[model samples]
Target: EEATLLLRYGQWRLRGASPDPDELQILFELAAMGGNAQACLELGLLCAKIDRQGERIFMEHGLANFKKALHWLERAGEAGVAQGWHALARIYSRSIYSQRNLQVAQHYLEKAAQAGLVEAQCELAQVCWRHRRDDPLNDVKALYWWQQAAAQGEPTAQAALDAFAAQPDAQGWALQAQALLTDKLRNSSPFLSARIELAATFGLTKPEALLIDIKAADYGHCLVVDICAHHARSKRRLIAVQTEAQRATLNRVSRLFGDVDCGFDGLEGNYRQRQYRLRTTFPDLG
Candidate 1:
């Protein structure tokens, strides 16, 4: 219902940022009775959102409610709720609370993906990438998941693509990033289609100005790809980035490993080749 409301309004404002405390209490009362897992999840997310409202909670407030929300979200996830999987994934993906329960995070995200939640599909990719030190990234797989979400006209996925394409040499992280955008161009989303044409024109000149930007971005930034442990085919490509956010966009390079350690190397021609070699390899998880 919350998702539907947000979709209907064409914005989240329809649901307001915070749920009324009095209303939340009634929902909780209903949730406590039995198969009201939905209410439990809503109440949980409400409390969680409220707890984060450091400036809104008028009086009684602490981190307790935030923690309580997690408890309820977990219960709903256990009850096989798709929303619970996504909610739990959101909690786990946050750098703030992610470190708290990684294993649980993976569990919920996978469940969500199985339940056909595109948001959870995205989260599961992250969870899979973060599972170990050297999980391979197949940009194809990344594109696959992004395609699923983007096809639904999901703004977050579109935002992810906007952020992804903004990179100077986006191809270095994943051929699929380009493919993902291209797929959007071919099938749906006219905005991305126009974006593809712009990028092609930019690539034609092979402008060196983006080099300086890429160097600066690489200093402290990492590509936050929505990749799974897939060892797919490999390819040679160049990845140029401009902003920290674009650098942080989700992407996948097929079987290329160790990209995080590569500093500013040659920029003339083989930069993309070098990047591909240094990137994390996409394992043959199949």
Candidate 2:
């Protein structure tokens, strides 16, 4: 209960990353014993997402992790841990666990929703929306869960709500989400230099980003773009451009996507009249 409280109220922020190994061992042992499935699930995510002993060992060993994680989650689900059901739902939904059992996927996610996990609610809603809607999907239940998630102070939920609400203008909602995500992706990021490094590695002297699509869907703002580069001396530049509507969705894109090795070059330009180079790592040199 105390551990759950720590996680729920954000006290874990004070716990920091450098936890005592022995203490952490004891903590995990106790939590697993106590049927705190969230602890097991989170431990799995950490082990998978974080490096251990200079080796990235998570998904490579995910079969084992998921087994143990499911064990704890099933127990916690029976014991009425809301997040436990949520974990079980995620595992079942992911092919690693149940091997892509959509029926079970729906089952566990619905169970989690009944247990009041807003994240689960949003996910299940998307599933419902997908079955009923076409490209640029939407469903009433999906929108409801997004609203619920948004109201719970989940930034993702909020962004999603702004995307697909019943308003006449989904682009407007995307703009609202943009205002929320300004600080995370732009201005200060360690990966900021990584973008540049990629261009260097790919033999691209200059890369450009062209905004192809930015629109709100059933969940949140969706952004699609064509990025190009030129090693040619004459047209060596990167450009990114979007309509005002697209600019609003850009924030949504920044929040969800990390430094994907999509071969992105850089922000060549913004808004209309933006200048962008065309493709080719060796343009004029060739």
Candidate 3:
């Protein structure tokens, strides 16, 4: 019961509903002390994760906090949590804290994948394919790990495997792989604007529709584009544009969608008047 409560506190700390650092530290420490493996893992992740400005926390501690992350991760690993091993692998693989060792990363990834973690399998596959420092490229191992992840329904691994099958030399895949390493394609918002443009070009959505809000759905795989537009001379429509595509693969040519009712902030009052002014100002959009 104590462990459970501590775990709940740890989860609440990360919910972003609150920003009390002392509360987070208390929860994480209590949970970790109570032998909650998930808490240990989350606390380790919290410590390891770069701050909002892309800087590591506790820098003055001289990697003391990084070592603390590793300590908690090791404790979680001892508890037989596959995620702990995976997190350890990520920490080892990253250049953070002056400790980027691909071999050690691969070792932990093997442990995580053996314990049935799909993400670990995918990361292992990418690591195998990419030529990292002192780690020789191994396409055979890459294909093997990719097959493992794909069989478990990992779409990124499936896409990479398809790319490999199409071009054994992996010429076209280099750019894509590099992009993934730096997290360009992993980000979903940039694609939303492209999708919006496509919707306007095809008359699916009017070009002049005021883009009121946009957010991610399905764990950041799909975009929800919210807009306000005049559907007819007599009425204004607020629509939620749900773009559907294979996860992590949003080619400009790919098409998918759904919708929901519109809700807006600034445009909530004088809706018709604003709609008329917008339509008149952007006459070409309708």
lDDT of 3 by residue, 136-221 (tens): 23545566677778878888887866643322122322222222332342253332333333333222233222332322222232
Candidate 2: where is the Cα deviation over 4 Å? 1-27, 34-65, 134-138, 154-286
Q: Highest lDDT: which candidate? A: 3
lDDT, model 2: 0.45
Model 2 over residues 115-218: C-alpha lDDT tens digits?
77877877876787677435333355565666666667778766755543222132332223223334444454323322222222222222222222212111
- TM-scores, one per candidate: 0.40, 0.40, 0.49
For lDDT, candidate 2 versus 3, the one ahead is 3
Candidate 3 segments whose C-alpha is farther than 4 A from its true place: 50-64, 132-137, 163-286
TM-score of 2: 0.40
lDDT of 3: 0.54
Ranked by TM-score, the better of candidates 1 and 3 is: 3
Best by TM-score: 3
